[model samples]
Target: MRDFLTKKITDIQPSGIRKFFDIVSEQPDAISLGVGEPDFDTPSHMTQEGVRSIQEGRTFYTANAGLIELREKISDYLLFRNKVNYDPKTEIVVTVGGSEAIDIALRTFVDPGDEVIIPQPSFVCYEPITQIVGGTPVTIDLKAENQFMLTPEELEGVLTEKSKILILSYPNNPTGGTMDREALIKIADVVKKHDLLVITDEIYAELVYDEPFTSIAELPGMRERTIVINGFSKGFAMTGWRLGFMAGPEMFMEQLLKLHQYTIMAAPTASQYAALAGLKNNWQETVEPMRLSYEERRNYLHHALEKMGLTCYKAKGAFYLFPQISQFGLSSEEFALRLLDEEKLAVVPGSAFGKSGEGFIRLSYAYSIYELKEAIQRLERFVTRLK
Candidate 1:
């Protein structure tokens, strides 16, 4: 059995976030701030639409690219909101989630031994997926001083003749760092100079707090070279629906669609229609309110963490706060385990994200204000004891 397994699959470590989550599940009184999932239920209108689709017997598989109407809605949404235009007909492929879109994008462009530049303390999937595809994962450690935003110098520092793709996860997971238009433009110039393509994960785009979200694809010369991955999970609280899409130039999308056609066939049909309803009707009524709630929660958690003497970069998007825990003289894993043991509070160790995250921990604020407040109280007590 050991001989039969591919080293590539076997060598990859299991998700560190899930390992802690499973442990927390067994402790009945534990409060978990580890998982990055939205606490809100999928909007009522979207769920109702899914139920109606089934009630009306619309359960058959959609076309390989997905339901044309859904893609068209996605196209319209991107154009109207992000100012980037992608043709629904040829440039978009619906996926099993933004995760699948990421895998496919790497497969589409990267050849064996090609280099994929990944910034650290990002969502955990990118590096392992790059390895499974036989692409070398070149990690850049984003600094706390830079607010964890990847600078143009950082991008240029890792470029090589073998570099094929750069994975950009802004409104970043764990850190919640976002790049403004000017920052993106500078990075775009570097990408163009190096002739490298980009896979920009914008799953958290709609949740931005300080400023409007800007896509790299919206930057000059970027639309043709960047693949945008977004989905219903983060923005619409539809994680269980497992629905997302990737949009890019037709040339790359054609290859991506081929892989998706063979591997995925199409995204779930009911989910597609439900997502259409979300895009078409729920943005103002459902999505906006949820975003506002997250914003409020973020403010509370940021202030609370700072008051407790945890130095955290103020996150601009996403629901996470990555705070430096080095001053306590404990590894992130040690601090996290002790926090869980002493306070029955759970958070992800920063090292779980990457080496760059070693001195920190990621706390999610996607829970209710009541839960966050209670967690903060526990954390305060825990920190005082350590001091």
Candidate 2:
């Protein structure tokens, strides 16, 4: 028999989220906050536009770089919102989703054995994709004291000649951490010293609260060296749309666009049309309600966790709360599994994000207020038994 499996594919672990999702599916009436996806339906105008695009027979393949109008609109949107400018023609490539964008960016830049710097308690894709591309994933643990933001001091400690890419994900996954301009500037200083390329996942950029969002691309000398990975997934509740894009230096785009062209061909045509409406019309109607709702959930969960005697940080963006559970004297995985099996509540262990997350558990507040209240009640019941 032939040993047929490729090492790269064989070595990778399956998604931590999917592992739990399959479990929750088997249990009747389970309440799941384990997944990071938005519970809201995709906006109406976007759906109508997508159907209209299909009815008009616009289903043929778009350019590998994506529709020029969409790309240009993306450029304008980035410039206007993130204060980061990019040229649509040469500097951007639309991808299947932010996931694909992340993979392409790594595939384009990571030569065999190149090192990628990642912050812990981040979205899981960063490290796995880096490993699949034959890059070393160096994880820097972001602590609760820092609001889970990666520090420049930590960046300096990990630098080596092999380090090629730095992935900055904020408002982060699981932890809901975000970096302000000052924190980013400090990071920029280290990046400048190390001369590294940054692959920033700002998928949660539009979901921020209390403070304005900042993009690393807006840093001086950063736009050219940073590839900004964003998409319609989190912002427009378009996870199923599978539409995302990346903007960076033309040289990098030349490589990423090539990979996108050869592999994905183009992002889904109907989804792109829907995204066009998303980018232009109904922007506020689509995202604002979801953002406001998540903010409320964020505050509710934070306070609720505190009231239950868990130490929780203020989650500035994204819909998750990473609460320290060391007081419970259980590993994060034990806490999560017991909560699911005994309580019919589904939440992910923070350790699933990284070792730094071992003492915490991540609860997604993307669910409704009523559901959140129920979850809090269940959690309090579980905690009462813990004593």
Candidate 3:
């Protein structure tokens, strides 16, 4: 018998985050801050709308591009929030999730040997996806001195004739760093100079703290070249709904929709209706309140970590805190495992994000304030023991 498998798929490393999560799950006494998922339930209105859609027999497949009304709502939401206009009919394709939008975007643009410049420590998906698509993932190490935000110098340093796409994930996962408008303006200038296409993942946009979120797409001359990926998962707490969308120039979207049509056909119809309710009605009531709670938790955890003598960068968006853990003289994975064993508290090793994250550990603030306090106490005890 001959074994049959694509070497590309087999050669890729499994997700480091999930491996730790699996270990923590078997410990019944453990409290996990490992996953990046929002702890809140999907808001009631959105769930009710999903129920209504099912009751009304909306379980059938929508158009390959998704429900027109939902796409229109997404367009309006982006225009009002990000100040970028995309035609619902031609410029947007509803995806299974922002994850799928990412997959399709890479597939639509990257060819074998094309270089996709990815900044790290950031999300884990970009590199593997680029590899699967036969694209070389060129990683730029994001420094803590810069708050993990990608700099123009870093971008320029990684640029080569083969460089085709620059992947920007801000309100970034793992680090929780965000790029302000001025920072984006500098980045946009570099991107424009190099004529590089960009895939900006703004899934965490609504959860930003301290400052208003700005989309790179909103920068002048950027709307036509950037693909903005956003969804109901992070902001609306609808992760289980598995719905997201990509907005960009029609030239790209036209090709993207073809891949979506053949590969996925359409996003789930009921989920589309649920997302519509979220965009249209739940933004003010449900989304804002959840954001406020996350902000409060972020504040509490930041102060707590600092008091424990860890060097923590203040995160302006997303629900994570990446605290430098090198002072303990243990690798991130070793520290996390020991803490879990001694304290029954779980956190993701920062190295899961990238090699540059080796000296850090990412703690999510998506849990309740009470849970956060307990976790912090355990963390302090763990650090004291090391001291």
The residue-by-residue lDDT of candidate 3 on 355-380, one tens digit each, is 99899999999999989989988999
- Which residue segments of model 2 deviate by more than 4 Å? none
Clashing pairs in 1: none
Tens-digit lDDT track of model 1 for 219-290: 889899999999999989999999999999999999999999999899999999899999885465778899
Model 3, residue 92: C-alpha shift (Å): 0.8
* Candidate 2 TM-score versus the reference: 0.98
Ranking by lDDT: 3, 1, 2
Clashes of each: 0, 0, 0
Top candidate (lDDT): 3
Candidate 1's error at 159, in angstroms?
1.4
In model 2, what lDDT does residue 335 have?
90
Residue 224 in model 1: lDDT:
90
